[model samples]
Structures are given as C-alpha cells and as structure tokens.
Target: QLTGISLSGDQKQKPADLEKELDKLQTEFDEIENQIRAGSPRYAALTGAQPLTLAETQQKVLDDGTVLLEYSLGNDTSYAFAVTQSGVSLFKLPPRSNIDKLATDFRAQLIPPKLQRRIVGIDVVAEQQRGLGLVEGPSENLTAFVASSNALYRAAVEPASNSFGDKRLLVVADGALNYIPFEALVRSTDGADYASLSYLIKSNEIVYAPSASVVAAIRQSGNKPSGKNLLAVADPIFSSDDSRVKGKAGVPAPAEARGLGLGLESAVNDVAGEPTAAGGLRLARLVGTRVEAEEIGKIAKSNGSQADLWIDLNASEDNLRSRDVTNYRIIHVATHGLLDAERPQFTGVVLSLVGNKDNDGFLRTDEIFNLRLGAPLVMLSACETGLGKEKRGEGVIGLTRAFMYAGAPTVGVSLWSVADKSTADLMADFYRRLLGPASSNSASVAMRAAQLGLISGKKYSAPFYWAPFVIVGDWR
Candidate 1:
C-alpha cells in the first residue's frame, strides 16, 4: 500500500501551513534542475475525450522565497515526479471502476464462476454509475445482477436521488447456486421486495426463486403466499391487471407477454381499443382455433395405442421426467404461453399445474437439449400459443418455434386467447378429421383437415382461430 512516504495531517496543516510549504517548493524550482527530468515526455492520449493520465507533474508558485519540487513513489501505477530541494511528489489516480481485477500471460485464469442458473434474466428500468447514464445488464447471473444492482445503488449515491429504490428484477434458480440468498441481501440493503423471492416463470410454471421482485409484488397484490415469508415470496408479474408492458418505456414486450393473461383482467378492455389492423392480440386471436379436449385426447390415445389417454394433470414435480413425456405420441398443454420482451430467447409456453423446477416451469427453446419427439405432431391447445415477433416490421412470432426448438416435427399453436368452449368444439372437429383413417402423410395435411373443421362453424371463425394459429419449422 505504501512506497515509504506518507502525508502530514491536513487538518493540523491547515491552509496557512500548506501555503508556506508550497511557497518553499516553488521558490526553489531552479535549484533542482540537475535532478528534475526537463525533457518534454510524451503521454498516452486518452480516448473518448477522457483524460489519458491525471496531473502527473504539478509545479505551483508559492509566496515564500524558497522553491520546492517533490517526487513520491507508489505501487502498481505510473506517475510523474516533481523535483525540488525537498525530494517529495504526489500520486495521480483515475476512476476506480476501470482498473482491471487481474491480468494473465496465459488464458487459464480468466474465468469467473459460471453464471448461476438461479438467475434466468433480469428487468432493469434505469441506472446510473460512474456518471454513466442508464445502465442495463444484458444477461442473468452474478455479474449482470451485481452490475445492475450496483447501478441502482449508485443512483442513490449522490444528493436527492430515488432511483436506488426502483423496482429491479433478479431471476434466480430455486435449488441452484450455494451462495448467499439474494432476497435477504436486498432487504438488508434498503431495497423493497418484488413481493416475494419467488415467481412463476412461464417456461414450466416452475417458481425458480422467491426473489425480492416477486415478494414485493404479493404485498401489492394483497395476497400472501401462505406460510413462510421467505420460502414463498409473492409475485406481482403474475397479476394480469398490473403486469402489462406499455410501449411508453421503449422496452418491447415479449411475444408471449401477450399470452400471460394470468393477471390481465383490465387487458380485456384495453386490448379491444388497439388497432385491429396493427395485429397485436386481435390478429393473434384471428389466427386461433380451438378444439375439444376429448377429441384431441381421443386422437392422441388412438395414436398411442388407445391407452385411456392418460394425461396426468396431477403428476408430481419429481415424477415429471422426460420419460413420462415419452409415452404419449402427442403432448397437448392447456396452460399459458409467455413471450418476454427483454428475453425472447427465454420465451415459452408454461404447462399448467406443475411444480418441477427446470422441467416444471418455463419450457424454453433450449432446455429440450436432448428431447427427440416421436410424435409426428403436437398441439399446444393453449392461449396465445402462436405469439411471437418478426425480426423486421410488425407481424407474428409463432409459438411453434418452441416446439421446433424442442425438436417437434410440426406444432399447431394458437396465436391469441381462445374461448374454451369454442376451442373444445373446434378441437373435436379437427381431431375427428385428423384421426380419420384417411388423415396421413405429413402434419400439414392433418392441419388442413383440422382447419376445415375449425372454420366449418361461424362461431369459431374469429381471429381466435384462423389468424391466431400457424404451423412452423420442418414437418415430416
């Protein structure tokens, strides 16, 4: 920490004493030429209009007759030396955040702990750090979480700032990462909870972490998560009423955000006011077509050798293995679909009434890493099953992508909300045709048959059917 030099107490030194010392150093500047480096040494130019180096050399003229030029040495950094009768100098420094933690001649030491899976993603409003504006974390993990959290804290560092207490999100795994509990740390740090440390990720309906984000939400919702406060944090995002993405913040809503109608009682009224031509959920609904559960079940059962169509809605999380999924030739989830704005990659359609983490909640595009579909076709006969965004312009993003990502040959997903009764009716007709002995070849042919059944009735012709559903990826 030291290079053998230290400062005298400035409180005792005062302005008068410091002035006397400066006078002494300045008066004697001429006497130290033999020792002083008089050459015009070059300095590395700084970029972005920032300083390359701090004041390395400072020579001040003082009132006293004698002059002083001093040089001081320090550790791990370079600085200029001032030569005078008194052999003393000051050190220069820049912003602390920019200093690298460590350096290496080899690449082996460059890794940090792998990002904890507990944190799936985060949503940050705005943050300020080191005078930088609007900081954001691009991924979920300790580094990004800490960085985003640090930005919030930094916003409150200076005078009259409230950004520190703004709502911040951290997605943590329920069982992964053996580090300190993030929710507790936030509580100790003057932060409000997101209702609970827990939340329902649409991927699998698996509540990963009852994080602060979810906890604060529950309090706002006026609903308690039963027993323990920490064990079961409340979720605000689950409320269909308050959890809406208004484009006012310039943050794009995920494609599935449309489908997470779990909390959207008010959205029913709001969505009706939006331009139908703009698409949105209206277009999604236009594409949606519903079918009867019994009919689809019958078709799947016939395909699976007619084994009671045993779709266990009450399956335990531990027992929700991929093997259980293998028996059925078709998987039909009558739950919810979520497409997040910030993390469309984590976009998924959640299975209802399941409790398994990872597999239990939020079925993402990648978790099916080893899943191979034996089912020639799959139907996510759920809400907003086909919601997604086009890379360019305003169009539709298909829920079929997740099935495709999971290796399904062909998937039939609805684009928007569907009437349960109508969906049931449409499904019955669709399956009657799909399961007909003549229905064979590719999934497209079968879907056409289902479409025929869907529009056959005027009651099912809404966007909720025809416009809301789309077949995607390879269909063998």
Candidate 2:
C-alpha cells in the first residue's frame, strides 16, 4: 500500500499517470476492506494532524499590516474570522439568504441581456457591435448596486473594521459571497455615492485566499522563488472550418459571418451531444483579445523574458498538456470558459476545440488539479470563470481552487461574463502595473489601480466593465 504521495514536482503528473494512481489505490483499499470484514482490527482510519490556531497561523503566514478575513456561511447565519499580526477574532454576519439575494440581484444588474447569452444571429452582430451590447448603467440600477454592496460590507466588515482598519485585507469568502466583489462594495456608512467617497477600493488593498490552510501551505513552501516569465494562449481558432485555419491574412469570417445559413453559431446547448462536424466548440469571435495577447507578449518581452505566446490554432489543449507549464511565473489564459454547475467536474476553460491538432480541446476541472504549476499567478479572462457549485466547508468548487491545489499562489478570475474590449483595457493596465516600474505594490494594489482607471475612463466607466475581475489567492 502506498502511504505517502506528494504533488510537489515542477512538472505535474499527466492524466494517464493520475488515472493509474487511482486504480492502484482502489485495489489497495479493496484488500483492506476484506481484512476488516474478517474482524481484523488493523484497518483503522488515519487521523490527520490538527489545524494551526489563529496565533500559530499568524506567526507563520500573516505579514505586517496584512489581515485575513475568512467567512463561513450557514443556512440562516454566517461567521467571519479576522486574523491580523496582533491576533485573531471571530465576528457574526447577516443571514445567508440575505447575502444570496444581494449577490443575485447584483449580478443580474451587471450582466446585460445582449451579453447574457452567446450571440447566434449575424443580424444581431450589427446590434452587438454597436454600444447596445455594452452593459448600460442606469442611475437606478447603480443606486441599487451601491445599496446591495453597502449591505454586504456592513454585514461582513463593520463588525471587525476596528481591528481591520487601514490594513491590506486578504479575504476568504464562502459560498455566494465569493461572487461579491469586496472591493466594489460601498464604504461603510458614507452617504456619498460610489463615484465620490464610498467605494471600498478607495479604502483598502484586498486579495483572496481559498482558505486559511492554503495560506499556511503557501507561506510554508515559499518554493519557486523565481520563475520564467509567461505562457500566454489567446485567440484560439476553435473550428477547422474557420477561415483562419488555412492561415489566411486575417481571421476568416466566423460561421455566422460566412453566411453558413445557421442563424446562430452552434453553442453547446446540451453537453450530452457528440462533438459537431465543424470540429470546434463554437463561440463568438473575441476580436479585441488578439490585441490583448500581443500587448502582453510585448510587455513580457520588454522585461527581458521570452514569453511563449500561443495564438489561433496553436492554442490547443494538446499544446497545454504537452508542455511543462510550471516553469512560467505567469500563465495567462485569455479565452472562453464554461461552468457546469450541475456537473462540476465538467467545468473547464475552453481551449482550441476543433483544430487539426490531436487534442481533447476541453481542459476540464479534474485535469487542472493534476497540473504541477509553480507560477505565482494564473489569470483566467472569461465570464463566470471564478464560479463553481457551492459545498459547505469546501468553498466554491471551481477553477480557482484547482489552480491553488496545483501550486499557483495567486489567480485572477472574473465573477461574471465580462466585456471583451473592457477586459483588454483592464488587463493591459494591470500587467503594466504588475510588471512596470511601479510593481513594488502587491497584486491587489495593482488590480485596484487598473479598476480605478476603468472607473474613471469616460467611455468605459461603468462598473460592469471593470468590477468583475478579482484577484484570488496571495496579493504579495
């Protein structure tokens, strides 16, 4: 029987290796079960070590001026654990239903009807291309958004802000709370509007860790001190029928543009169906993302690091699986992502789905845990990529946790479906701050700066454009 298994290698085990290990474990467990049925007392359950106490955790993980706010949700109530360098304390929260209602209303307000689903009709392409596709910020919805945000902030933070005051906050959100952007929350009790003095981003630098234990493990390992620059895969050509498949000058017209007669691009309405003949998971063409990728590549190269930029047909799951991606300091996957809430295991980031390359196309949630990534940061620029099915004590079971278990210290993900052009603008600003001369600031600080930039912009000032992206895991 294998007693010790460690997933710490720079190169993570491939899916084949993981499957073999599972099979071997099942065989060993069967033998143990047979002995136990025969009245053998040798098959006792293994008892793990106790978790670190607040004080113990502090000495080990909390840096000066940094505080940890961990939330635990119940059917009717919630609890928060606030840990600082001085010590730790627990606080009470509003009912779970209240928080849930607030989050639901908040999301519905942010995501526009046009952007709600994948556009299928070329007829709507003209409409979508117009500003109508951009999320509109009516004054009433903005007021409600601020009100909902204020309610959440008052519930989650006011109880502990005396101790948490002015410190860089590291939040460990639970359940529906994960969908709430703590930074976007209105400042406590300030009568002023979000445009003026009430936004939380104006007050504190915040980042999120999956759990307190994760922080301890990260601080303890401190491995991968320095890493190679980046591996950026964007603008994947998902179908063999795509005009770009033949290396035409520009992106050949998508199915709708080519007048394929199918009104909308074939979206995966039912996961049970077989792969379509077109040979790729069909999605709207993300025209702005090509520039997003090129800009980041240029930035990484200027920093004396050769970032491997895989675009169009080359950005396949096969390319990702074949490479030892742990070497990079950053892994930027800018593409469409899907969440199968009914079947969490099926949730994954969509890569080049139907290319000529031998590839499974989908990088599912299960496969992500098998990766041994050493990058400090992994950015997922897709809608609702941060979400997952909720389970008590476990937190949101999604891609964010998968990456952390696979060894990334930080992940940048979106809470809702984001506008493509706005994402490009925010990311370009974010990387510039994270990699430019002002990089002395932590990830969350840099993130706030980027968000503020978008908030202040004349054209893209709506919170819907910039507020969805949140940095999960370590800010430092």
Candidate 3:
C-alpha cells in the first residue's frame, strides 16, 4: 500500500529546500544501489517515523466550514471520505464507468465551437439563458445534462454536503475524476432554469488537492517567497519559423497565419451545420497574451513589488529550465500546454519554440521535478494542462503533480481548452484583485473573484468560458 507522509509539526524547511533535500536523498540512494551492485557493504538508516494521523491532519489544515472530500477510484467502484476537523464520514459514489462518460460528455459541451455566440451588453441572466439555448439545443439535452449533474452530485456530494451546509469543499480527486469541474455540477431542487441554479459555484467555493498529505505540505509552506513578487511568461513562439524569430515585429509567418485562418474557417463551417475534424477546433495562434503579461506586470509594480514579464523570444523553455524559480512568489505561464494522455510523460507546456536559433521549447513532465520552485502558486494558463493518464493509486499522473513535486504549493490549471482572449481578460482581473491593496493574496479568493467577473461580466458569462479554471493545492 502507498502511504502519504505529512510534514511533522516542527518541520520548517521551505518547499524549495525540501525539494533539494529530496534530490540529495535520491542521489544517495542511487549511490547506495551502485555500491550494492559492486558487492560493497551498504547501510541505510531511517529516522523519523511519525506518520500524520487523520485527526492531526484535520487539526493542522482544516478551517471551520471546510470539508475535505478525498476519493479512491477503483476499476469499477469508487469510495469517498468527507473529513472535517471534527469527524469523518464515508460515502459510496457512482462507479468510474458512469462518471467517466458523463464527465466526458460535459467536457465536450464546453468546447468553444459548441457554445453560442456570446452577445455583449445583455443582462446576465438573459445572456446566460441565450447561451444555454444555443449550447443545449434540444430540450432533451438540457434535461440529460441536468440529470447527469444531479446524479453526480447526489452520489458524490449530497451525502456529505447536506451535513456541511454551505461550507467550502476541498476535493482530493482520483483517476478521471481529476478532470471534473466540481463547480459546474448542478443541483436543481426548485425547478429553476438552467441559468438560474445550474452551477455548484453558486452554492460554495470548490478547490482540489492531489492528496491529504499534499494539503498539509501546502499549508505548512504558506509563507510568501522573498524574491520577486511575480513572474509572467507569455506569447511564446511555438515554431522556429515564426516571423518574430527574424525580428519582424512579432508577426506570425504568412503560412502559419493562413493556416490559422483556415482553422477559423473550418470552425465557422462547423458552426454552420457542417461537420469538421476535432483537431480543427483545437487550432490556436500566438495568443494576444502580451497584454496580459503587461497588465499583470503593472499590478506587481504598482505596490513597489518586483515583477518579471517574459514574452515572445524571451519566454523560452531553456530560460525556464535553467533558472531557479524558488524565489518568486507567483509564476504564471500563458502559453499552449500539450497534453498527451496516452503518454503522460510527454505532456509539456509549450514555450518559445526557437529564439536566437537555439533550444527546443517543450517543457516535458519528467523535467518539471528538476526545477526548484518554492513559489506558493504557479498558474498554468493553458489548455488541458491539468489532465494526464490515470494511475491506479497515484491519481492523475500529470503536470499538476509534477509542479507540486517541484516545490510549488499550489497550481492553477485549466480542465479544458480555454479561449485565449477570455483567458487574458480573466487573468488580468485575477492579478488586479490578487495584487491590490487590502487584498488577502489568497489564490482561491482571487480566483473566485476572477471567475465571478467572467460569469457576471457581459462578454463571457457562459460557464464554458470561465468554469474550467481550477486551483489544485492549498487554497489558503
């Protein structure tokens, strides 16, 4: 059985320092193995054996009105434990077979091509209703979606949620469940319309953790980093042939631009009742995220805090891999994240493809643990960066855990592909709120503010545009 060891109460090493220690231990273990292979006498001694108990973890981490829902997903069935500081309750949720399909269906509905044309200057409720009509075209689709959400809620949450009332939920999901948007799960008891009471976010704040021990690790390392306050890297060149590589004023190559145009044309064709390949909808460009970097940079600078904003050629993978980001308080990467679920180790964040004629830009999953990043929060503003191949006991084996293993206490990631422009808007709002005076600097609080802005804002009220972003780690 796999056991998660939490940090002892007196342990005070920074996450980066802890990461360094782990690396040293691994090196030592490797040396010991070599010595054993050479037929030399080798000995290893273990010191501390105080594994954190359930009560100790609750006492150390759970605040009042906070419920931790930890899940264990087996091949056919799944079990859940709802824990608070006071007690724990177990519940049996729907099997993976049922949830996998429903969640996949919900995710398919969130794709941009499936959503309605978002009209500006309309009332929030009206706009949301319009979006529902377009996205959930048939009346039966709305009923089915609602039924699916309600079924998930009842099985996974209702048993525990009723006891916790309006408490915020801290979910530790496993397997395909890691890809779920808990906030989007609906509970309709009063016959309210889809836009009126269709989302769990309307009821409570939801966050995620890789494990209970990870939560303890995060809370123990909650102190802010002492180095630069913000590091925002965005708008990287994904190809060496990009015009910006030749210093042509940050323009895309003519062929690439044309390809993007064709991609859009194909998307339009899909919207006009013509079938198109799923890859067509996945098309992306050198996103206009330079503005996002600049706006966030201004926020960090406003309060006499230091901020480093890297864009275009400067946002190379080599730059990220070589630098020790342990000192930064916040690290934000606004680029494409290539998720290879079939080969999770190949999953990587796309950075500057080639600049100054050097360095491949894909930052692979395996390479993440090599970095020492003690930042309290690392934001991946990219598509499906949160997903990975499911392991039996390890949960989603992806970049989120990779970043955590690298020493980041929290990682903000997207569950699905998001619109570049909407992401920029949401991120700008998030940073402004997070870095402002009188701000709590609590990532989840700031994230909620940003999500609320998108949900209520005129331009992007649809849940598909905003609900995908989730904070997985310490919400504090």
Candidate 4:
C-alpha cells in the first residue's frame, strides 16, 4: 500500500520520479479496488461517503461572491483550480521547486531566524527579536519580504485574478504553499511603506480549508450551541524556580531568563529537551498570555456571555481533559506549541507541566484527537501551531486537523513564532470584534478586522505580527 511509502524521504527522489511512482502506485491500487468491488458487492458500503464531485461541491459548498482557489504542486508545472459558483477556471503556476523556494524565502522574512542556544539545544534569539526590523523602518527584511510576497501573488493569485472578483476566498494550498498566508500577499508594490501597502486582506476575506470535501463536511455539521461563551487557558508555569511555585527547587533557571512581568515585546523563551527525552523540560514563562486571557474573559463577560479562565497551575493537561471543555463556544489556549516534523504525532500545545502521574505538559496531536470539542472556534495562540507534517493529499496532518476531527468547525492558528505582546493585543481586539455589539460574529471577518487594526497601529504594523494568524475551516 502507498501507506508504506516513507514520507520522510530517507531515499530522496527527484520530483518527476516521485510523481511517476505515485501515479504507478495509484493505478495498481485502483485495479485492486476494482477487483475487490467485483468480488464483493458490499465494498461500496464499506468505503463510507465518497468525495464530492466538482458539480456537487459547487452546488453544496460554494455560494455567490465566493471563490475556491485550490492548487496542486506538480513536477513540471503546478496548476490552480479557481472554482466559483459560475465555473471552474484552470491557471498555470510555477513548478513545485520555484514555488517552494519563494514560499521558504517569504516565511523566513516573516519569521526571523532563531537564536542558537546550547543549553536547551534550541533556537531562542529569533523569538526575542521577532518584529524588530519592520519597527525600525524599511529594513532589508521588509524589502525582501515585500518582493517575495508580490512574486508569490503573481505566481499564485494574479494569474487567477479575473476569476476572483470582489469575493471571499477559500484557499486550498498544497505542499510548501501551505505555509504562505494568502492574506499577506501584496497585490502590487506601490512603493508604499510596509504599513500602507495594499495587502490581499484589505480587499477580500480569506479562509483556508484542507479540501473541498472537508469544507462540505464542516458546513454540513453546523456549529452546536454551547452553554458557556469562552473557556481560556493560558500562562502555564514551567519552572520550579518560578515565584508562583511555593516550594522552589534547586534546578537552574532557563538561560537569559527575564523578569515575569516584563513588557509584551520582551524576549519570549521556549523550553526544549532532547528530541527523544521526556519530563523535566523547562519552558520560559509567557507572562503576556495571562493578561491576554484575562482581558478576553472580561470581554466575553461584558458581552453577556459566561467566561471561564484558567491560568498557572490550573492550566494543566489534567484540567483540559477533565473539564467539560466542549460546553464552550470558544476555546482559546495561549501557551507554547511544539512542532515535531519527524513525528507529527508529537506535535503538541504545551500546558502547565505540573500534573499527576499520567499528566505530562504536552497535549500531543494524538491526544487532541480524543478531545470532545463542540466549540465553534478553537484558537491555539502559540508558536507555529498551524504547522505540521505534510502528507501528499491530506493537507497538514497537525493540530488543525486534530481539532477539526474533534469537532471544531473553525480554528485560528499561527504560521510562525508570534510576538507575545503583539499577539495578546491582536487576540484582545479579535475577541472584542467577535463578541461586540453590531458584530458580524464571523471568525474570518473578525480576524481580518483585527489584522487591519494592527497594521494601522504604530507598534505592530509589521506583517510579522499581524500576518501569522489565519482562520481555517468554516468562516462563519
């Protein structure tokens, strides 16, 4: 079976060779499936619901003033399918290699290089200096990023511009393109400063989906009404030396550890252990998240909704699993997110490590699949929560998919390591817009508004701060 194919590429093959091999394997699998169907009439029943065809998807999933841009990265030449209610238009895109390089360069500019550290065997400095370049005015990083963004727009979106009038976009990106935030792409470089540049977000609301079939399924299973409004978990205490910990242990504090109440843009630290090791990992404290969560809870309450806030010791894996978290309309977790590319199952959101025998701090992807989340939205306000191992046709097999399977209609995730205070500020504005009076009450709309607000502000006007967060799945 194709499942046996090592996605890790232990023996790397050229793109052309890989495509040929996949095609050959798929043909054999199809013949075997045909034989099975001929042998037993019950084969169809065993296969569950088949994927929706283009016509079915157009009728059932898409609406007027909405366009679905789906891309398939190929060996020789990539293709983009612009699916609207009117018709499906095909556009030629750059080859996989070209798109991959552009996407990598674009992401690098948005997320600065990580600082090398020997103690935790992790990169720390980059997180501390995330949005420094854009703040200092038209640095090399900003210029390079704008160039890359515009190039990507030409390669990915501009070709299909005619098919996409003034409409909401449902993007299905493949391979490396999955990491590129579509909303951040510049329409055309007008020599405007970073803050005033014409971003795609300014014109259209965008939402991402793994596939058309997934979109149909999510829309079919509409959001269930929840008793509580918001359940926010944040500010997990990682070190025993933390002042919040009553009995201070003698373990050394994390390197370059700063004061707890430092401002938002202060250096945020990550706790790392040997890739194979578990337990005794010391994550730097996220003091800004405490304020972030509290402010969100207050907003929910003022908007006439019940809000539950969990912080410090209370924000543990035990509490996450034990509590009736499914009862809330929105579940916001603000903490560290660890991405395990080699082992996607290990990709998890870090909560308070202080727990009982079975509880470790990590809420790994496999564990998230077991969660019963009925919330309309689940926001993982942490570093690289949107990233995961890429499976050929399965989109990103990471935290987003796990939550979707667990019953969240929509999810908000970060593409890169986000600034602490800027993220908090963005989330506060997002929640206010989401729950406020005269609100559209749509996740996609609120996200766009929040990002626009950040761009207009002086503090976090850079794409690094506002562009990382994207809404996936049901826009409403």
1 or 3, which is superior by TM-score? 3
The count of backbone overlaps in candidate 3 is 0
TM-score of 4: 0.80
Better of 1 and 4 by lDDT: 4
Give the Cα error of residue 44 in candidate 4, in Å: 15
Positional deviation of residue 387's Cα in model 1 after best superposition, in angstroms: 2.6
| TM-score preference between candidates 2 and 3, better one | 2
> Candidate 1 on 137-247: residue-level lDDT in tens?
112232333333333223211111121122221222111111111121211122222222111110111011122222222223332112100000011122112223232
Q: Local error of candidate 1 at 410, Å?
A: 1.0
Could you tell me the lDDT of residue 247 within candidate 2?
57
* TM-score, candidate number 1: 0.36
Decreasing TM-score order of the candidates? 4, 2, 3, 1
Instruction: Highest lDDT: give the candidate number.
Output: 4
Clash totals in order: 86, 2, 0, 1
> For residues 11-80, what per-residue lDDT tens digits would candidate 3 score against the true structure?
3446466446545654665465446435521111001113358987688768897888888765677788
lDDT of 4 by residue, 63-90 (tens): 9978999999998999999998879999
What's model 1's lDDT at 50? 21
TM-scores across all candidates?
A: 0.36, 0.78, 0.74, 0.80
For model 2, residues 225-263, the per-residue Cα lDDT tens digits are: 254487788877655565677655453333222222110
Off by over 4 Å in 3: 1-52, 75-77, 112-144, 189-195, 219-228, 247-284, 356-358
Model 4 clash pairs are: 115-126
In model 1, what is the error at residue 244, expressed in angstroms? Answer: 30
Decoy 3 TM-score against native: 0.74
Q: Which candidate has the highest TM-score of all?
A: 4
| Segments in model 1 whose C-alpha atoms lie over 4 Å from true places | 1-291, 299-304, 307-321, 324-328, 352-360, 392-399
